[model samples]
Every structure is written in structure tokens, then in C-alpha cells.
Target: MKLSTNYLGTVYQFSTLKEVLAKANEEKSGDRLAGIAAETVQERIAAKEVLSNIMLGDIRENPLLNPEEDEVSRIIEGQVNERIYQSIKNWSVSELREYILHDDTTGEDLKRLSIGLNSEMIAAVAKIMSNLDLVHAANKIEILTKCNITIGQKGTLASRLQPNHPTDNVEGMIASLKEGLAYGIGDAVIGINPVDDSVESVKRLLHATHDFIQEWQIPSQNCVLAHVTAQMKAIKQGAPADMIFQSIAGTEAANRSFGITASMLEEANQLAKVHGTGTGPQRLYFETGQGSELSAEAHFGIDQMTLEARNYGFARFFDPFIVNTVVGFIGPEYLYNSKQVIRAGLEDHFMGKMHNIPMGVDICYTNHIKADQNDIEDLGVLLTAAGVNFIIATPMGDDCMLNYQSMSYHDVATLRQTLNKKPAPLFEEWLEKMGIFENGKLSKIAGDPTIFTR
Candidate 1:
């Protein structure tokens, strides 16, 4: 069987794994890549063969496979896997640097190359890449790093507002938002997973957030974590439709577990487009995690990380404003510990950025996991270095409703101070206008004095 596809703006064709391996050999020989032993070259070829066979098996058993398309999909996946392995296996540090600097590689190709690399290789490559290169790669993939939903642009680090109220009370939510905003967080977007999924409850939250943004002139978007249908109802009822939120998985069955379908996503996307709110054309905000497939009994023998990347393809179809992978939020059942969590988070970010999706990570841990703030800090720093679009910023890193520890307001501040970063462009402008920021530095504003009164 033969297959063809475009990767990083380059068209590639493959008839067999050996053809891909031969290309790798050619590149290696042409570049005369230093320090690579002949034994290592042969080992990489063997690894490529192993990966191709595994992908072929995965395609054969894919639950989404239809009789009409299964053969074509199998052939395509085989070729894709072979190409990915070939690209990474022969990549030299200098070659990768050149690609980062001058190659017109797209996010899709980056994601394919990323998924083919291990965590160690990702870290090593990241060390050699400048922040500009990382940001440029993000743009090539069309990832939105700013909270204002700008595309194909790079700016300061962005964060989200995740305030949870036990009874979905509007007042409690407002108070939390006030505190977060006072600390210079929530500039990216303010989103909440409603304790109540009812349209009335979600609508109230949306209206309140919408009103708050208008009253305070906050330069951000608002989202209520209800089903797209319910959010659509709220939008029709005059609630703000800044962004629509949903949890997505790779396979149809896994997505079905969350009461979502591709058709439903399409309907929501159309509704959001009709009810324009943000500064950009994109409006969908999606969240995904690694173990969701297995939890929904939809793994189909594929590894969790690979399945997570596949989910991003489903997400990319919507031209989403943000595609956040809630890494380590699923608990120890999916990712065993900090090492596993860290690797998965990196993999998810790399894959998402490579796909040119506006990627964010909820660098978090569940109570059942044997991880701590230090682990989250390390992962957050690495992701920031890799130019991740954003991360969740909660009070003290603990999410009250979700029962997980994520990056905190202090963490965001620290990241900015340590990395000399700022907030999204519009938000930064707003902050400067409000005297909250001066000369690209955050002022030492005291906490909202009226937070307690509110």
C-alpha cells in the first residue's frame, strides 16, 4: 500500500517502512551528523519497524473504523508513523535548530515529530531552542497564547480564572474573580465548571461574569462549564457567549461518555460563531486529559499519550480558541506519579502545539497522587519554557470544586517575574491604563480591599 500526506509544509510519500528508513539514512549521511554510531542508526531503524507494526494493529482495531475507510486509514497511519519515526530518529541538534530558525514546518508536522520523540529528547531539544523559536513554532501551528483569542501571534504568558462555588452562587463566584483579578491573574479568560449544569444556574453565572467584565471593563472572555446545548440555551436567553467549554476524548465512545458527539460539537461551533463575543474568529474552549479513554473503556489497546494526541485532531476541527489538556488532573489511576505526570504533560503540550492548537495545561495533581507543588512547579516552568499558551491559576494552587492542586496566582506571578513575561496584550494594556502595571512590571497592589465586603 502507498500513502501520501503533507507535513511541515512538505509533502511526503511512503510505500513501506523501509522507504521512510531509507530517507532517514539519506539525511543522516548527507548531513554527516556527528556522534551517531552505526549501531544507533540500525537500532533506530528497528524501532521504526516496531512502531509501524504497532500503528498498523491500532488502525485495524480502531473502534471508529468503517469497512469502507479502514484500509485507507490503516495505510495512512502506517505511513504517518513511519515518517514520524524517521523524522525524529535522524534529527541532529543542529538540524532541529535550523528547522526552528528557517524551516516552514507547521504545527501538524511538529506534533507528529513530537509524538514520535520521548520526554528526554523533548527536554534536550527544548534546551537548544530559543524562546522566539518556541513561540514561532507555536504560531506555525496557530496556537493562541493570549487570552484575548488572538491567533498566529506571540505575547506574554496567559492564565485562566477558575472560581468554583458550591451551590453555583453568583456572589461567591464574583468574590473569587475579584480576588484573582486583583492579583493580576485571569487576564487570559475567566472560565468556571458550574457545580450545576442546569441552564438557569449556568445562565446566572454567565450573566454575572459578563456583567462583571463590563462593569470593571475587564479585557477577557467568560465561559460556563456546562454542556454546549445548555450554554446555547443560556446564550439565547441573553447570557454572554464569550466561550463554550466541553471535555473531549479521542474515540467516539469516550466522547459519548461526556454526552458529546461530533454533530453536537458542530452545532455548538455554529452557535458560537453566530453569537460572536471575543476578538477573534475562534470561540470553542475544550479540555482533554490522558486517562479519559481508559476511564470510559475506549482505549482500544493504544497508549494513553497517543490517544490524547488523537483527541487534539478532533479538537482542531473546531478551530478552538483554547485546547487545554488537564494533565495530571485525572488521578493516579491514569498517570502513576510525578514522573509520569510530567512526561505526559510535556507530551500533551508538544502534541497540541505541534497541531497549532491554542494549548494550555492544568498542571495539577489529585489527592490520590504522590505528587506535590514542587512537581507542578517543575512541569509548569518546563512548559513555559516550551511556550505553552497558558495554565490554570487558582488560589494557592488548590481547586475547591475540582479537588485538585493546580498552578496558583503566586505561581503565575513567579513565572512572569522569573521569565520576564507579561500578560496578554489587551489585558496588559488595560492593566497599564488602570495603573496596575507600569513599564512592563506589575505594581504591588494590595489585595482587593472590598473583597471581604463583597
Candidate 2:
């Protein structure tokens, strides 16, 4: 099966409502920064403005748009929203009532809490779903999500699925799935961990993961982050990490991850279509780096294989699609007042925005081991120094950050906090630098400006 889900067609997307009024009658929205009012006291007003700000945009830049990438075509991307009742469509109706009312600080008794959905948001999402030819594909577009059982702390998403749920979360499994179905989620992404670079284990794990996907009520896909452990180590040691990755003399685990990854692709052909999203060739993402990024030869080889597989393409094997990345947000592992070194991985890699084919960043934690505030800030500084782009977060912008999901909002907050601490960037002015009317053409407002400042 060629994993060809690129944006061959159009998709619908828009800006947050606040952007509209500022731009209405061509009123100056000033800069992206000027939009923040310091506090969101009247949310209802935000909804009405959303309608005005909501306009047609292309899927090529929208990460949620089905991309040619098998992974993108099948995964759901977005920070959660409870500001609107309509956000209900994003979750199953029954499930919404379950956690809809719980305060972000309550900390426990998940089932008993009521976490409300942003009704207006759901309405908007529903309207989008309805227009996607729901009548024809609703039945075929099975929606579902799978969580990684491994996670930070005992009270986080990863913890909830602990014990037997080590591979996937069981506590919210049903509800998450129901939400997907409600919002027309096509599939919940189940990512393969420890892509041990082994031929045998990779093959087995692929089979196991694919099987897991098939069992779900909705169509599903598997995600594997191309983690270059050796590269990472090398970068830290300031030595050649790619050599360790490519010339692995005794790294059996690395071999297993690659092997399983390859097998997963091969197995997709034999398995029922339900498990994976595409049919011909699968697209694979290779991380970027020199001391760590796969050598040109390694990347070339993978690209050649993908091309030989039917031209479905390989990421990092060539110029990447404008969108597509591995990124994540991390909350403080512990509440310490200390700080450490932080690094931004890439310039293009960013969070807080979606593009056709699940664009953004693929990320994993490095100093997540109970670093102090100063340490975390240092980490951000390091990432900024390193040029990392995306950072995940909780839905409502809470203190837990992305790790614990305690009312977190915008993984990009890392960038904001990082920038705020270091240099006084004219973020709003900078955001305006790109989107002003360039000749007769208007550049689309993209990800938050902070994602790129590093």
C-alpha cells in the first residue's frame, strides 16, 4: 500500500475569532501580539468573532488536512478545547459529560468529574465534519485514538493507562474513542515506542501494532518517531552520533526498532485495510541532524527504498514536505525551583499549527527527569539555542504544562516563556512581517511567531 495521503484536494480551516474584528473593515489587527488582551473575561464575544475570522484556507498548510503521508491521513491533531459547548463533537456526547465539569486542579476521581466541551467549538467542528461528505464517508471514516501507556508521573495520561494499560490508556480509552467517533475522528494514532533498530522485533511489533489498530471500532494508523538515540547522545557528547546509529556494532535494540518499522510497512500490505490507512508504500520520517541526523547515505538509502516501493516518498530522505515534524510539550516532571539547559531542535519544526499531512514536530523529552524551573528554563534556552520549534501543552493553558495535562494551553507556550525570559522579541511585529499584503497576494497567517524565533 503506497501511503499517499498528500493534499491533492482542498480542505477547510480558519483563524480564531479574535482575529476577525481587528481585521474587519481592514481595521489594523496591529500585530499577532496585539490580539492578546492579557485576560479572556468575555468568551462569548470570542465565539461570534470566530465566525467572522473563520474563512477558507488551504489544507497544504493545515496539519489536520489528510496528507499524502499515511501517518498524516490517519492521525487526529489538535489541543483540546473546553471553552465551547460545541467542542462536544470533538468528544463523544456521553464521554463529554464524564469529565466536562471537573476543575483542572481537582487532580483525581476522573470518572466522577465533568470536563465540559466547548460547545461552540464542537459546533464549528461539526459544521466542518458535515461538509466533509459525512453522508458518504461517515461509516467508512472510523474515528479512534490510542494513547501511549508510558508517560510522565502517576497522575498524567500515561499513568492513567498504567498496569495492564501500559501500552495504551484504558481509563479514558472508551471515552476518547467515542469522542473521535462523535467528532468524526478517522483514527487514533498508536505510536510504536523504542523503535529498537532490529529487523526481527520490528517485524513482530508491526504485526502487533497493526493488529491493535484493526481491533478498534474506527480506522487507525500507527506512528513511529524516528528517534536517533545515538545521534542524541553524540550531540550531547559533541561527537559523531550518526556513526553509532549507522555503524551500530552491537546495538540490538536499535536494530529491532528499524526492523519492526520496516515490517510494519511490509505487513500493511497483507493486513486488512482497517488497520493502516494506505495501501501501496508507507512514508517514513527521518530526523535531521549531522552529528546526529542520519547521514546523507542513510537518508538516501531510505528514500531510495521508498521510491523503489512505489514513489510514496520518505521524509528527510529528501526535502521534507513543507509540513511534517516530531514535536511534543513537557510539563515540569517535578515542582522544583531550579532550572537546566534547554534546546530547540529545529527552525522549521514547530507546534501550535497544523498542516496537510500532519505537519509539525515529533518530540521526546531529554531533561524531563525532574528538572528545576531554572533547569527547565535552561532547557528552553538550550532548545532555543538548538533551534527547536514545537512544544505541546495542556488544553486550557494550565501550570501542569504539557506533561500532566493540567489545563495546559498551547504547547507553543514554551516558546513564549522562553522568548519572554531571554530576548525582547517584537513577536507581534514579527508576526506581521510575513502576513501583510505582499503585493496583491496576502500571506496566510501561520503558526505562532514564537515557534520560529529560536
Candidate 3:
């Protein structure tokens, strides 16, 4: 009921929940560009103070985007457990944050807590959490999802081999794919970002990666990141897809801009269930980022962080096998530099995990974002330490097709070895059998694409 807070002998009052949410966020160019960020550091702290004391029930009742107008809101609302909500409806955001950070709180407790809270509550708590607090809280939770292989088990890290090409060249993608596999990557998936989003091109790439997995008897899944409609058409026409992929946003209007709707996603999920090549019920892969809603002009004055949390809320509805945020790929406009990218990456991973989704991060940056490979490499290490399910890797961290840099095959190997982690269980076994990995480390033949050529 109260939207005013006193800090350092000054009174700060926010007129609406949206204003408080935006002002409470850490400095982000996207928010500033949207003209909603706090005007001063003291104002930012005051907003956090106001937000922390706001009740969970108040957030739920306020509904930033009306469910009547937004399907994302409806989806998130439908998923909240009413019984669980009543039990924690009176808890303040600060109370919830501390409860999550409390040493006595177990992973199961957090899981149960996730059921009671909605995306707004999740985002609210994240605003007040420091970087390490986000990591520490997220590290307590383990979310495991299975496609062809299980990912996100404790002590295991996974990688999605993105073998993108400038012209949809199969051989060029295969070159990168073979090299990545040699380094014990691609356990999460051999996913590609196609230069072509056509059904035929999608099918071609899917078949290429699928056949390679079949020939090598590799323990992994494959996807081509085309439009959901293109993938659906390809799958219906008998494309051998291990998983269906789509990029999702936080609002109905943004989703429309992406050419998706809840019903359309539901149809895609059903199609994958019957026709997808993966082994289980979880077959959808979604990529979300912080600034997507704002980019599409659908944020409705809300901050990017809250919109991002809404993404996880929507993603969990379909029970995705894997979900990742391309944290820095939207460029410096959304996340200005390494510091903002790192903060957003950690926030996204933690928020996704809090939503109980299999969360990964594309620790990445565009060339013009005042960030280099080293910045993303630092993020890759941080996310891995926080028990991220997987990360996106390109050949030498360069995606010639997308013109962005992410973590690399070599970085995946380094993260695994340095942090005492392994790939997904079946993938690790296949690696050891292929002599790419031996005794918990890469073998002599590792990092050689020629090994797969034979």
C-alpha cells in the first residue's frame, strides 16, 4: 500500500509499481534509453527500499501488464499454485530474499518457494540481491532437464555447439561441429543459428547435425534456430529434429513482433511431442534476453530485468528442455558494457533457475559493445560457478554468421577442467569412448576435427 521510502534524510515516493520496478534496477542503458531509470543513486536505493518492503500479494494483485491484455501475464498467473500463494502471500520481498539466502534453506525449499511466487516477486527480490547473492542463491538450486541426454546435474556443465555459417554452408558448419565435439562440447545440444530461416534450410541443417549424431552415435541433441513456424513446417514434413527452438519475449506485443503467440507455441509443443526425435517430453528450447521487450516497444514502461523474469515465467509453462538468455548479444544499448552484461547474465541465470527452468547463458557480446572475448570469458566462469546448466559456444568464440563473440570450445573444456566439472553423463561416456576425453580430461587426440573425419 505504501510506495514511499525514507533513506538518508530524504523521502522518495514512486507513483506506480512500474516506476518503482524500473527505478530499483541497477543502471542499464536500456532502461535509461526507455527513460525510466532512476535519476540518481539515492533515488535508486530508495526505490529498492520501497520495493523490498512491498508485499507479494500486492505485486500479484497489481499486475503490471493486465492479464486481460497480455497472454504472458495470463500464463504466469495460471502457473502460480493457489495454495502455495496463500501460504506466502503476506511475505515481503526482502523477507523472501533473505529466506532464500539463509543457510538453513534447502534446494527443495527454494523449489517450493518458486511455486508460491510469480515473476514480479522473483524480479523484485533480484533487484535487491548483490551479484554474489544471486550466485549463492542460485547455486543452491539444481534444475535438471532431459532431451536426448540429461543436463544440469550437480558437478556437470554442458555446452551447446553453435556452428553457424555465413551462407548456410553445411560443410562449414560441420567443420566447427566436429572441432567442438572433439573438445567434449555439444552435450547440451548441437544447435545452429541459421543464416536461412526457411523450412528447407532448417531441415537441411537439422538433418546434417542429426545424421552426424547418428553416425557417431553421439549422446546429444540437435536444433536449428529458425523461426518456430519454419521449424514446425520442417518437422511436419519429416525433418529429423531432436528439439524445436524459438526466441521468446516477455509481452504479447513483443511476441507478435517475433511472430509467435501462446496458442502457436502450444501447437509447436504438441507437434514436437509427436514428431520430435528427442527421447522425452521436454523438447522445447527457448532463448530470452533482457532488452527484447523494450526493443519491440512492448515493455509498457517496465524495466528490462522484470521483463526478463517474465520470459522465464512464460518459458516454464511449456516445460522446456533448455532455456538460455543471450545476455549480451543485444549489444551495448541494452547492457552497456562488461559490468552490465555480467550483472544481467547472473540475474538471468538466477531468475531462470528460480523459475525452475533449465537455465543456460550465452556469455556473449557484440563487437561494438565495448566488450571483448575476455569479458564474456569472465562471465562464462561466473555462470559456471553458479551451476549454470549450459553455455553457448562458437568456434574460437567467433560466430561469423551472427557477428558476435561467445564462449568458445576451448573455453568449455577449460571451464570443465578448471572447475572439476564434466559434460552431461552420456556425452561424457561417448567422449571417453571416442578418446576425446580420458580420466576426466581431454585426450591427446582432443581438439582435432580430423578425429571425427575418420
Candidate 4:
């Protein structure tokens, strides 16, 4: 599509379709419009193929799909098995410790979620992807889809995009995008739930989101997704303290994932007020689960908080956290929520004993996402095969124990390889991938792997 641009008052300047197209057909066209016109022509040429790759969300510049998908499952299985084995191995210790009175060795500790990718790190990723031209060449121009980006909104800036989820359908998404394009969307669309607490809040939010885009009036597309936060409650409950703790870990994690530091929110708020945003949107969300895992009321509470946040120009980062990659929301795409949280906590608990490694260590996922529970084993194997680190387990998965009777050759090979690579690559790979170096770093995955172990 031919995109046009216009000055967004004090916010942004975008090229509009009408203006750009009319100019392209102008009498010998103007020089200022030449670059944009040419870019438009190129995008039209490749839009179809590019769009398809995007939908797949599986396009790796390298034939690396093998890793993201394959390694995830195997690594998870390994963890399950490891846990089982440890439970059995440590059984004798329980009795022995009882006799000893005092504990001889300490347990593992949890830290914050193992450092997965966060918004703070997007600039560098944008640079890498831009170098790879993950976004369209012309599209990449509007933002930092180039070069290394500094963390926490440094000299670099992030182009915010809301997902389009008008009643959860393709048409809704497309219509929202179309409307948003007219409003000057540069990088992506973030779909949000306009409904919460009261129906009126829903209407107001939806209208506001639309108005925000319509007001901006620019077109450039990237990172399209839906923002889904539902209201739900648990059927059988006992105060849900455990879930709440888990949820808090998850919630704090979501906050972190969105590149949201306590400082950042405050800054955004300040920026809004200074710019006269009339009390910026203050969105927030709570974590929820289906099956027996979550309560409906719990879900609703999360929605209420998220809803209130938006009233002040804030957004929530809530969504299905199967493996906690923090996917599908405005917050962290770091994923690995439940595991990372627990893992982080565990690492902190055992800081002194386990060489002070964060409880949350990276596992080797093949750099893939799990579409369902079944593919986990395959995903885990691929990760082990390719050596991606920090494989977080899926919700319903067998521990990563090598069932001699049921284990496959592939699984065996992967574990053996993984074993050889200890202390662990999850930490090393995450650090390397995240651009965190070993110059006195101290997470379980950081510093010397020698200090961290299973």
C-alpha cells in the first residue's frame, strides 16, 4: 500500500497514502517525495512474500527453525526428568538430614526471571534485525530497526504499535490496522481489550485507541499482534496465595519484560504530562490460566488493573504465558514466565551455596516457540542439538529425565551433548544473545559456568 505522511502535531510526522500517491503522480514529482515513492514501489513488489513470512512467525534467516521448535520440547523433558531424578536421588538426603539436625548443604535459590530478552534490549535486536532487514527497508527507516540500541530509552527511541483485536477476529485486526495506517502507524499494531470491569470502560478504551491512531495518521507496519486480557476466576480456591505469589513473580516479570522499569513508567508519565496527555494511560494486567491452573476472578482482577492503567495512558502486558516468553503483549517478549519466576526465586534462595547463581538458569530451547504440548520433546531435542540455552519448561510436560525404556536415540544424544557443555549454556547463551558479558556478571547463567550446576 502507498503510505502518506503528515506532521502529527507534536507527536510524529508520517507519510500519508493520499499525499504520497498524489505526489508520486505529480508533474515530474518533487525531490523530497522521490525517496518515499521509490520505497513504496519496492514494498509493493515484495509485500506479499514478506507478509507471509511474518504470519508464519517462524522465519529464521538461518534454517534455524530446527532449533526454536525442536529444542524447546526436548529441553523441557530433560528438566522434568532431572527433577524426578533429583527427587529420587535426594530422597535419602531427607532422612539423613533429619538425623543430622542441621542441613549440610543449601538448596538452590531463585533470582528474578533469568534474563531473557527484554524491551531494554530491543535496540540492539532492532539493529541486528535491521542489518538483516527483518522489517522492510523503507519501513525500517522510521525507527531503530538499525544498529545497536541502548537500553531503557536512551538516545534511541521505540516506535510504539498496538495490536488490533476488535472482538478477536481477522477482520477486526485488519480494520484496526487499516484505520491505524490512516493514522500513521510506523512499526506495529498492539491489540488491546477495551472491555474491563464495566462495559463503558471497554467502549472508551476501544474508541480511544482508535482515536489515537486516527489522530497520528501515518502508515508503516511491524510487530502486529493482539492484546488479550480476560476476566476470569478460579472455581476451587483457598485464598490462592500460592498462585498469587506465582502471579506476583509473573506480574513483576511482565513489568520488566515490557522494558518497563519503575523509572520508565514514571518517565513516560512525566513525558505525557509535560506533553499535556491529560493524565497518561495507566494500564496494568494480572496473570490468569485455564483448566485448574487459574480462577476466573483472578483473571478479572488482572483485567481491572490493566483497565485502570489505560485510563492514564498506560498499557498492560498480559497474555497466555505457556512458556513465559512474554509473547503477544506490549510488555516483555522474554517468555518463560512461570518457570523463569520460580527459577529466579530458587536461584536467589541458593545464592551462596550454588556459587551464587540465580535460581533461574537458562535451558537450551532450539530458539522456537511451542504451538502445543506435544511438540515439547521435539523442541527440546532440537535445542540440545543446536545448543540454544535456557530451555524453560512447558505447563504440562514430563520432566527431562532419560526414561531408559522410553527414551529415544535423539533424546539420549541431546542429553549427552548437553551434559558435555556444562556448567550450562542457558546462562552463557542468554548472556551472549542478550549482549551481557562475563565481566563480573553474577547470575547463575552469568560469570563462570563452573560455579553453576544442575
For this target, which candidate reaches the highest TM-score against the unseen true structure?
A: 3
247-277, model 2: which lDDT tens digit per residue?
Answer: 1100112224344233343332233222333
Candidate 3 structure quality by residue, lDDT tens digits, 1-454: 7999889999998999999999999999999999999999999999999999999999999999999999999999999999999999999999999899999998889998898889999999999999999989999999999888899999999999998999999999999999999899999999999988999999999999989999999999999999999999999999999899999999999999999998999999899989999996689999999999999989999999999999999999999999999999998899999999999999999999999999999999998898888888888888989999999889988889999888889999999999999999888989999999888789999999999867
What value of lDDT does candidate 3 attain over all alpha carbons? 0.93
Please provide, for model 4 over 183-275, each residue's C-alpha lDDT reduced to its tens digit, 9 standing for 90 to 100. 212121223322232333333343444454345332211211112111111101111100000122213233333333334434433332343
Compared to the true structure, candidate 3 yields what TM-score?
Answer: 0.99
TM-score of each: 0.74, 0.26, 0.99, 0.20
lDDT of 2: 0.24
Q: RMSD of model 2, in Å?
A: 22.8
Q: RMSD to the native, candidate 4?
A: 26.3
For candidate 1, what is the TM-score? 0.74
Give the best candidate by lDDT: 3
Residue 141 CA displacement from its true place in model 3, Å: 0.8
Local lDDT at 437 for model 4 = 26
Residue-wise C-alpha lDDT for candidate 1, range 17-123, written one tens digit per residue: 32332222211211122222123444444433332322322222332333253322232233334556564555544455466456676556665565454322332
Q: Could you arrange the candidates by lDDT from highest to lowest? A: 3, 1, 2, 4
Ranking by TM-score: 3, 1, 2, 4
RMSD of each: 9.7, 22.8, 0.8, 26.3
lDDT score of residue 394 within candidate 4: 17
Off by over 4 Å in 4: 1-378, 381-389, 393-419, 422-454
Better candidate by lDDT, 1 or 3: 3
